[model samples]
Target: MYDVVIIGAGPHALSLLSRMLINTPDKYEERPDNKSLFFKNKSGVYKTKVKDNPQTRNTPRQLSTYLRKGGVIDENVLNNICVIDRHGGWMTQWSKQFDALGISHLRSTSSIHPDAFDLHTLVQFAEDHRREGELLEIDGGIRGSKFTGPFIVPSLGLFWDFCKSVVKRHKLEDFVTKGFVTRLLPKDGGYDVCLASGDVIVAKQVVVATGNIGVKRIPGWARDVYDGCVDGSLLHTWDIINNSDATGIHTSDVCKQMVKLNMRNPINNTGNTVVIVGGGLSSAHLVVKAAMSGADQIHLVCRSSIKVRQFDLELEWIGRSRFIKLADFYSMKSFEKRSHVVRSSRGGGSITPYVHQQLVKLQESGRLIIHEDTEVWECNKDENHWSIQLSNGHMVDCYIIWLATGSIVDVTMNPLFCDVIKELPINIIDDLPVLTDDLEWGCGSGLYVMGALGGLVLGPDALNLAGARGGASRIAHRLKC
Candidate 1:
């Protein structure tokens, strides 16, 4: 029995948990009578102790079923707020995923980290690594690149080291458990968390940060038209490459597969054709990686004109510096206006400044081709190759098709909280849950959401580190931690 239970032990969860710990009470002990609530719920449902606060009692019971939101959890809640994750340890599989994808650094800037007090934790991390020279001032330039002269991108190695340091400094490993959360059912004053390991956890508060585990979106167009034509040629970024049962999970199977293909047939061979669909930051990175990996020919198909920018939403939303602007947008009373603002701020097929330059260079050298303002309408698996027809009537074929189409946020895909969701009288819009002003999914239930699932209130920044910070701060304040 715990006060709060965080689901998913990734970067977002780490950030939230760090803040909660920072605000944790030196002595976290519930009253004698209140403490027994822990053992009382062993059968499945726990009768939670409620506060006498009117605002809390009237609050709804809605919660972001899948999220990793943060800030100073109640001190009494700290001891009980153990983290639950499918993968063992913190950020192990996530780091492996990035390594497999060949990503050099995160799209976010340095100020974003798990430390509740240290906004410059990552920046300080780079400095401590004797890589101060490699540290890029995130301003007036690309999100993660230097502002001037030689554009320096933080190597993934540096980022991994920093993550390890955070986990170590916070002693996060002690509070984590390995198991996939199969379902969450609300009863009495709290929720019951069921895991694949045949264990049940009763939590008064919950934060879910499952990174859309195994949930990939490959565009309904291709799936509905061609059935078996999309077999071996298609792959999603989140899919485990080779399905390794190794210690940590890897989300870079597509990148590794393409690299393997490039290894078998070097660029000089000119035999293999690799087509990459979607043009977001992931696709942008994939294009550079695929071209450099010796793929004979690479085609980048984007539905919209490739918009080059630092971050996905806007230059202001980077790091918490300009986050106030986003908060202002969230305050709007008009849902239509809010939806429009979110849609207009979206940078769907956008690439970083450096990747934009790489695309230009690739095109000039005739190594990579860009089908801008086009989409893959149909695909047919041919004899050891894939035949693809673009929305613009263009046709091409490739040995493999890596779809960087991104993840699906449709809450229906994830049924872990179906029982809980049904019991809550919460409103849903656009397949997203409606949240309160403080980003809490419900008012009094102590249920908060972060990541893509909290987009309704966090706006476009919900899934990023900045949003995690904001969510943490709000929840911590609510808990008076």
Candidate 2:
């Protein structure tokens, strides 16, 4: 039995693991009465005698010490913890999404990353690698704040490299078990994590770090039309990006080159037409990527006018006044109000200025068309061509249709929590479980949740990198206690 079994190996999971490892108690002793074994419980202190030692603080010296130790890790933590993911690798899905969408840079700054040892670890890595050029500074005007920049926005390649270094430094690669968890059964104050491969791992504590484990939001008109279309012709951004072999495009700098090439030599007309639905960042990326790939008539269909912003939420949420904003969010006694704040803060899917600029350039060259205040009323597939009916009473013939509509995360409908809800009986508000301040499911249940599910507590940025850092730190601190 493992002390802790974490489901999912995304950036959020990585953050939690890194923090837990770095903060493990320096010394521990088996209880005298229970010397034969250390029984696991929600308290996490059934038979262990831990000294009142300050956790290894997040400092440069501590990080250096951890690195110098090389292959050595705290057995008190590593031996008892296990991480599981479908791909069995850190940030695999994240990289795939970026590659599929042809994203070259990240919207968030360097301050927000997976490493919990030191907040500035990524910036340090850039300096060490002499890859400072890869770190692009967000314009002061775009930042909407007085805060200046030192090229804090690290390129995709640089960020991935830094994450790889963190994984290697902590020797986390070998700790990951490749498996798809289908169900989590609570038994004897613990959980029997059942995987699709017919294997079960028992653990005292479970952390659900799966990002966006929600139902795909398919427009009502396209629901039935999707099944009738060719396998690859109709797909959601999630499906295309998550599937390994979905997109043939190579990852990384290829996307940057394509954008530049398409802008320089615009293709005014061609036989291919690709229609993209939605106006989020993914939609913007796909629009440019499709045009770059030589799709002459690329149409972007959005129900509302395009919203351009540097980040998903406003800059105030991540700026110097972030704490003040967070305090206001937490002051709310009602989850409904908190949820409203999250929705209002997000203000629906918006694209970054950089990607929006690319779309503008494509539109100017007459290769791309933005259909705002429009919706796909109906779609019919005929001989591999999609006749898309718009709300404006216009018909469009396209070879492929891409749905960039985001997902809807309803915890009540999530199958993983069906049994958990029955066993623990926690209050559910707007499909989000009312978790403890520590993000625990119920009173001493040992099961925890992160990501969007923790929105009530973590606020609007619960699904972003900033949320990863905050959520991971809170959970790690709870585990230590």
Candidate 3:
């Protein structure tokens, strides 16, 4: 049995472990001048505001009960903690995912990191390593200066290396096991984390950071329509690039295979036109990647006009605009209001303006073609290529159809969560669980949640690094370490 079973090896899980291992000062509080952006929890905990509802299993005051007598783990809890992941190599899955997505840098600022003690731990690490020149200063207004500032975006290399450093410092890899958690059975004092490999782990407290976006979002049309086409070059952005088929094949051999296939079938050749469906940053990045990878025609089919901003959310949303508006939003009786606020703040997947600018350049140079406010009306695999029908009734034939649509957030998709909902009273809002201020799944339950599923308490940034830090702070504060 373990003291705490931190699930997933993502930034949130790493953040929680960092906080638990090291006693860090909650230094550099949110700026209060922008009342809209700053939200102080008052003292060390939130006040008990219980709503007298007979049907609800947990009253608001229940959170205060957990806070009053929160969790406790010795500094050596790292040894007692059991971390589970299918990949087994801490955050190698994330590294693979980011690389597969063709992303170069993080969308979040440098201030956000897994280090518990210092917000600028990453920046310090960069400078200490004498690689300060690699970090780029953000040009947008209200930039954060030097340490503990979002004014800088860490290169993917810096961010990845920092995470590895945290793992090495804590020796967390030794405690992590490789397996998929298929079921979470809550017992009297803890939970039985069952894996796909049939091993079960018992823990005093279980933190669910498995993330909501496990699978890629594939439209029904694509899968249903292309059921029997071996020549079809359809793929998701998350698909393993170096699949088992391409494992032993050298790059030259793989090219020869494609050449042979192209000679046998002209329609399967993706050396020219490639249609990328979706309007998110993933789609934008992939569009550019396709062009660079030698696809001369990069056709972007967007269902709606692209929403391009410098970051995920606008600057105003980061500050008073979000806090002030969300305060009024959270006070409402229903969870729908808070849900709407979270969704509307960063509604659709958006590309940064820098990407938008690049796409424009690509378009002007005739390397990229864009179809805004359009989607696949209907089409099937033809003899030559996949014939496409746009929502605007345009006809086109393409060699590749790439779907960069983001993942789905359905709770039912996760068997572990589905089992939890069956046994416990899980309040669902817009398909996400209504977590408490402590980020716990329910009242008095040892199971705490982080990542996108913690949207109820994390406001709008539940899925990003900011949300990861916020969730970790709450969990850390409620600890008796």
Candidate 4:
């Protein structure tokens, strides 16, 4: 069995692997029968640590010696740690996703390194790979399985060579790269991990570092709406990502096709109105994307006027610069008392300056309309189009409607843990895992959760990239037990 098995090849898994290797136990020649040298777990075992026996410590000591000789680490503790990207190619998927969207820049400034693994000490290890050759490099992507054995270190091939060169230049050889992890299950002693290809690995201690890739929470309302609109012309963001012919069309072309599909049929010039519902960043992006795609008239609808308040100084400045109207209905006195509650309950902010500038230009040209303090009461479809009723007593006649609503954590979407989570003895908070402070799910011992799935446990920041790093670090520290 392997010492650790991390699920999902995303950044979270990579970070955890790096931490595990860095904190791995080292053998010493001074002590022969020391079992309690490292930290103990709840069961009073000394966890996983190397012994200090002269004969047994030779290999580990030699490895450490080699590392020290190469200037990889000054001490043995640093040598034990290994950190590498779970994916053979670093940031390949993320970079592609961004490139497809024509997003040369990020909506938020993220603190991530080129490798995407975010541990300070582990990064240092990868920077010094030339001096220490102990770190093994694996290349095969993980396939799915339930079997577990000693951690299988796959061959790195050319990828390993590139990583080795990077480590040598950066002095980070202590970080080893093992390809993606596909599936994980608890075993008799520790855990069994299955790879994407069908390889089985057994480890004494396993860490499931699968990030949010496999988990998708389609909100209840969204699911209902998606089902209802399937026959009509409605498309979700997920659908767009999954169904689009990426190579065949540009981003604008995809958006235009989506808009056309949403319209259901050829729309008359006077009938081609679009309504986008939501108050979040995605909604704002949709507005601009739709406008760019040649929507004649666009209407943005939100439940409360708080949408305006969610804007930051930068966004507010953009709003002023663009002259976009702000709408809120609550009495000023009542708003003063409920502002804190509103901020806490209502999630997400509005448009960014970059988007706001574009939106303002559109509005100036009389292309966009904003409707605030309105809730969608009901939507009735006719043979020709849809008629939407708002709580504000206004009626919207449109050829297409786009629900840019947010997501919810639904375990049903994840086939791997669907049955397992259902059988576990734990409380599901807000339909999400009720994790402990360490981010471990209440039902499983070794299995931990991060990313959007842990939203109930981590609050608003749960799905963010930085949040994944924080959750991974917390889970790693707990595993040291």
* Highest lDDT scorer: 2
lDDT per residue for candidate 1 within 123-242, as digits (tens), equals: 555654567665554345553322221223455677667767666655555668888889988777777889988899998877777755556777876665334543444666555333
Clash counts per candidate, in order, are 6, 0, 3, 42
Model 4 regions lying over 4 Å from their true place: 18-104, 110-185, 190-225, 246-265, 270-272, 306-349, 397-399, 410-414, 422-424, 442-444, 455-459, 477-481
Better of 1 and 4 by TM-score: 1
TM-scores of all candidate predictions against the true structure:
0.79, 0.85, 0.83, 0.58
Tell me which of candidates 2 and 3 scores higher on TM-score.
2
lDDT of 3 at 142: 41
Query: In model 2, which regions exceed 4 Å deviation?
Result: 24-72, 145-151, 246-270
lDDT of 1: 0.63
Candidate lDDT scores, in order, read: 0.63, 0.75, 0.68, 0.46
Worst 10 residues of 1 by lDDT: 57-66
Candidate 2: 10-residue stretch with minimal lDDT:
25-34
Q: Which of candidates 3 and 4 reaches a greater TM-score?
A: 3
TM-score of 1: 0.79
TM-score of 4: 0.58
Rate residue 328 of model 3 by lDDT.
Answer: 53
Best by TM-score: 2
Q: Write the per-residue lDDT of candidate 2 for residues 271-372, one digit (tens) a residue.
A: 467789998998899888787766767899999999988888876676545654665665567899988998899998899878888898999999888999
| Winner of 2 and 4 under lDDT | 2
Q: Candidate 1 at 222: error in angstroms?
A: 1.8
| Per-residue lDDT of 38 in model 4 | 32
